[model samples]
Target chain A: MASLPPKHRLQSSAADSAATGQHEHHRPRGLMRWVLTTNHKEIGTLYLIFSLTMFLIGGVFALVVRAELFQPGLQLVQPEFFNQMTTMHGLIMVFGAVMPAFVGLANWMVPLQIGAPDMALPRLNNFSFWLLPIAFTLMLSTLFMPGGAPNFGWTFYAPLSTTYAPPSTTFFILSLHIAGISSILGAINIIATILNLRAPGMRMMDMTLFVWTWLITAFLLIAVMPVLAGVVTMMLMDINFGTSFFNAGGGGDPVLFQHLFWFFGHPEVYIMILPAFGIVSVIIPTFARKRLFGYASMVYATASIAILSFLVWAHHMFVVGLPLVAELFFMYSTMLIAVPTGVKVFNWITTLFRGSISFEPAMLFAIAFVVLFTIGGFSGLMLAISPADFQYHDTYFVVAHFHYVLVPGAVFSIMAAVYYWLPKWTGHYPHLRLSQWHFWLSVIGVNLTFFPMHFSGLAGMPRRIPDYSLQFADFNMVSSIGAFMFGLSQLLFVVIVIMCVRGGKTAPAKAWDGAEDLEWTVPSPAPLHTFEHPPQYRPVEH
Target chain B: MVNVVEDRRPQVRRTVIKTLVVLAGMCVFAFALVPLYDVFCQVTGLNGKTASSAQSLVHQEVDDERTVTMQFVTRGAAGLPWRLEVEERQIRVHPGQSAEVHFTFRNLGERSLVARAVPSVTPSPASLHLRKLVCFCFENQRLAAGESFTAPLVFQLTRDLPPEIKAVTLVYTLYPQENDTVTAAMPDDGKHIDAVATRRWADRSSGGET
Candidate 1:
């Protein structure tokens, strides 16, 4: 692995890129410019905007669920609709919102970081991004279908999702297949670009942590997206073709569904979070005015987490009558994940220790990600203990545990990346005052929304239910209020991106004082074409 | 730069092709997991499915000192209307000796229905040696409404069966079958046309309520 590149090398690349200023002007105009664009930046913009739209849509689905759970009685939605909301919320957030957002960031950054002119396959990139809208549109239209959208939980355990599934289940299976194909394509492009397109003389180890994580994440995507495709295809068969892959009535085991889903699913959890680790890894060091602690260790830890994710899938099936030995194997393997995760958290903290740390919005989210994501991790550890999980399974405690990791851990990291890179993307600093307001409100709102779930879940409030008894009413009420608060503050984020794009404080080529990635080597608001000529090669010295 | 990009084109294309191949293999691997999961459960005896089929059955002298209790329990899958009852609900047997248990199934549904009863074992490890010589689970049964059909379940537990397992409970759950071949086997009582009967069957299977 190459050591950290020294600062002077950046100036040379910048001068070299500036010298070759031949930006192309023959792009398609108006709607077709976006519709048929193959440029990485344009596709990146489409992915980000698309993810944000999905985020809002998924957020409303959450609000609907929250509204129904605001009291003991089901006031806002029926039990059937409640199931749809929860299912859609999980599906949309994971597949539509979070995954796309990360890919969008990767598209915008991986090429720039590696000094490539574009993604390895730009047209494929366009196709992958376009697949999502079709996949999600098909999924959403199922709400209007006779039997309604997938009412099984996001896991879609069969025979519930097969023999007993609504008429819309086949469509659900198709939509997921489309999305899985999209993910596989996107992953291939990333791996190709990273492996084959780095600037001359920059070895694999010299690449930025963001690029490193995406590379690993991309391989994971390739490996597991197909399994997802496989599992859903099985679902499709069971639903339409009368095959019994999951239908116990047909001699297929329902437990097999959990095994297959989690095989794809547990790794999918890491798919959402590993890049967040990379983002925070990038942001914490930049704002702290320090080189990242244990950069090699961080990469190893990310890999370790991805590997361990596979072995720990059965932990999710602990309550399903797994044999004792199987239970212990999954439980121990799951707990072992904490070691690598601990390394990451410790590395971040060490980077921040006694450094010239700044309280920028990006830094704030990065730090919050450290504190709150750890909270999620602790709950995860609690849930990992096979016996304790019996108490917490399907409870709001389980709900609280994941939401903490997802909202604060993954979503916050995305926020941090957006804030950290906004200057480079738009050539202007975000409105600082409004950004701070969004930050504080989001932090408070997120905590308020998910914290009480631990109490209610311990009090035995199950998840995905439209009604709870009177004991959980107060927690549900406070949670709904916080949900609205958290949901509304995200609108401010949309405003900040728009305002920063339109006009704001100017940012120089090197956006942050301590930033060292090659992305900053190009001018802020990077040109359509960059690194057309591979900049003269010189690996930086630490 | 154009030369660098062009030079790497072959490598990128190779990498993409290889990755796509892996993607296809994994998709196939997921389907492979179906039989693999069943095999895994059978080997571990974790899901109550037996690993020992008739081919693996071997001759063994009876272990006179050890007696094992075999009990029969039957249930129906969601909407199955047949009631399965064994003539001998509980029987004591020597580990290596063969035993035959008779089961009677009566279709409670209005029309003749095709059914299959799948067997499972409790304290799952015991299933590893629970061999079936002749069981009705090997084929489907069609019983007319209120008609009772009897079948024999002949099985042997190897003498090597662990002494710690004094008792084994075999649960057989009846599930309605809809195979095209079975439809011919089903004696139509002239209750309704083929289309209407099938629609009702489909509705009953999915609806959870007849």
Candidate 2:
């Protein structure tokens, strides 16, 4: 594979001497670079901005939903429109918001962290990011179609999605197919880059936790995204060809849909959160001014969680009806997850115990994730109880549980990561007061919005309903108010990010007193092309 | 040179072991795929046995249009209390045609409710069938109280319903009423029908509860 001969290298060196510093001037300039470029960093920036825009759009949809549910009796939108809100909100946040945000972070950070010139497959990376806008365009365009957007919820289960689905479902499925392809290609690129392009002497164990988690997450993506593609394809076939893969008359079972979905679905959940674990793992240590506690255990625990994720998916289906023995098996396997998860939490707390700590916005979000992710985990355990799930399944309880995981768990970590790395990316610190307000308001608003859902769910309020009875009125009202506040608080984050980007007080190479990482070893406002040569690896001493 | 050769030998051995282990793992993984898939199906109810049947009820015709008061009884899943209401409260259908009815259900419990409608015919062995056109309970119904919306069901006398079947009765089961108070008020007697039961039956089936 080493195609360049020694003579060619020598001649190139002679040519390089002739134009030593002129290379920078010759770099690609203007809009042509952005539109028809293969630069990893530029594509990464585009992905981040695009994801942020989608996040706001999805947040608006959520605000609409919360507004209607605020006082109960259809104040903001009709039932059909409300259903569209829920459906589109879920689709956008998952595919457009969270996943893209993580990919953006990966694109920006992975090459620099790994001491590579750029992503191994730069063209594929550009293709992945560009596919997103096209996919989302198709998805959003469905809202204007006849009979409105998909109202059967994001899961798009059988029969409802097949027989009763709107004309827009075809477009929805095609859009998701494009998105899935993008995800798969992105995952493959990440894997190949990590495995094949590491700087000489940069071993697997020497890599940062974020890189490792993403490597595994990429594997999970390759393994299961195809399954998602398979299921959705079957859905399309069922819709078009009159196949019964999910229909009874066609000698197929509808519950099979749930099984196949959760297979991909469970791993998909981990895909969203494992990067969160990596993010927290990085941020917690930086704030604590100490090497991570139980580093090996953290790695093993993450691997254990990924493996356990497959076994425990049936917990989602306990109410769908299964044999008692199978139920017990799934229940126990699901509960066992709490053990490894507990290990991660304990390690984080121990890292924080005696170390000098400062509550920067990043640290604030990290600590909040520790507390709230546990809440989500506890609710998951509750749902794991097969008999207990008979009550909680598909109710507001389940809704509250996942929101706890996703919002406080995944979304907060993304915020923390942004705040933590903002200095490095921008060469300046973000506005402190605004960042603090963003943190506090998000903390309060998120809890207010999701907390009452537990009560309403326990009160027998089902999820995905356009409207509810008078009894659930108060909690829904509080939640809706909380949701609006939460939505508005995110705008503060956007402002903080924008202000930091436009330029703020210049930062030192080492931005935080406690921060210690190879990334900080480089100059702030990282060079367009970074670490052309690998840095020496030195283990941190406790 | 001798020392470097010795180091290379161990590296080679380690690489061989790693490769063998990975190959073994791959084989195991490939072997497990089918069983794992089957288990996945069974657990997720992908087998279709656990799902509600879409088979319509055999339709029956009644010779008379006399106002026959058909009673509905409902019991919800445990720990979920529901209240149901119909917009018109009743419907009149011709001997050969169908009628559409709308019923709304509310969750009065402090917790979220997961309820499904199990449509049963009142006269056993009668050929009368009910076809749901639009229903909230088709998959499952999640209702937040102070939150209520109507679900519509379309049904016709399948033309095969026994002529002897004059009126059809639909029963809904709302299990696990959220509060003990709600459950205690109604008890599990064959006769007594409460708000939760009335709501579930109305929302689930097309009949008035007395």
DockQ per candidate, 2 decimals: 0.50, 0.03
lDDT for each residue of candidate 2 in B18-124, tens digit (9 for 90 to 100): 43454345345533543575566445433322213223333456535533333344445434567765555445554445566666667676765555554444553
Q: What residue pairs clash in candidate 1, if any at all? A: A5-A540, A6-A540, A6-A541
Report the lDDT tens digits of candidate 1 across residue range A1-542.
00111222333245454543332245456788789888788888899999999999999999999988888886888899899999999999999999999999999999999988889888899999999999999998999999788899898998888878889988888999999889899999999999999988899878778998999999899989888888888888877788888866567888899999999999999999999999999999899999999988998999999888889999999988888899999999999999999999999999999999989999999999999999999999999999999999999999999999999999999999999998888778899999999999999999999999999999999988999899899999999999999999999999988888888998898999999888888877776666777765567642
TM-score of chain B of 2: 0.47
Per-residue accuracy of model 2 over A1-542 as CA lDDT, tens digit each: 00011121221234443542365455455666666556667777888888889999999999888887877676768889999999999999999999998888888778767766567667778899889999999999999999999998888888688767898998999999999989987887777667756656778887788888898888777777777777777889988886667664334557678877888899899999999998999999888888889888888899999999889878888876565777899999999999989999999999999988889999999999999999999998899888899988889999999999999999999899899888877778888999999999999999999999999999999898868899999999899888988999988888888888877888787898887767786667665555554556565543
Instruction: Give one clash count per candidate, in the order shown.
Output: 3, 49
True contacts kept of each: 0.70, 0.00
Least lDDT summed over 10 consecutive residues: which range in candidate 2 chain A? A1-10
The CA lDDT at A423 in model 1 is 86
CAPRI-style docking class of model 2 based on DockQ? incorrect
Residue A49 error, candidate 1, Å: 0.6
Chain A of model 1 scored by TM-score:
0.96
Chain A TM-score compared with the true chain A, each model in order: 0.96, 0.95
How much is the lDDT of residue A279 in candidate 1?
94
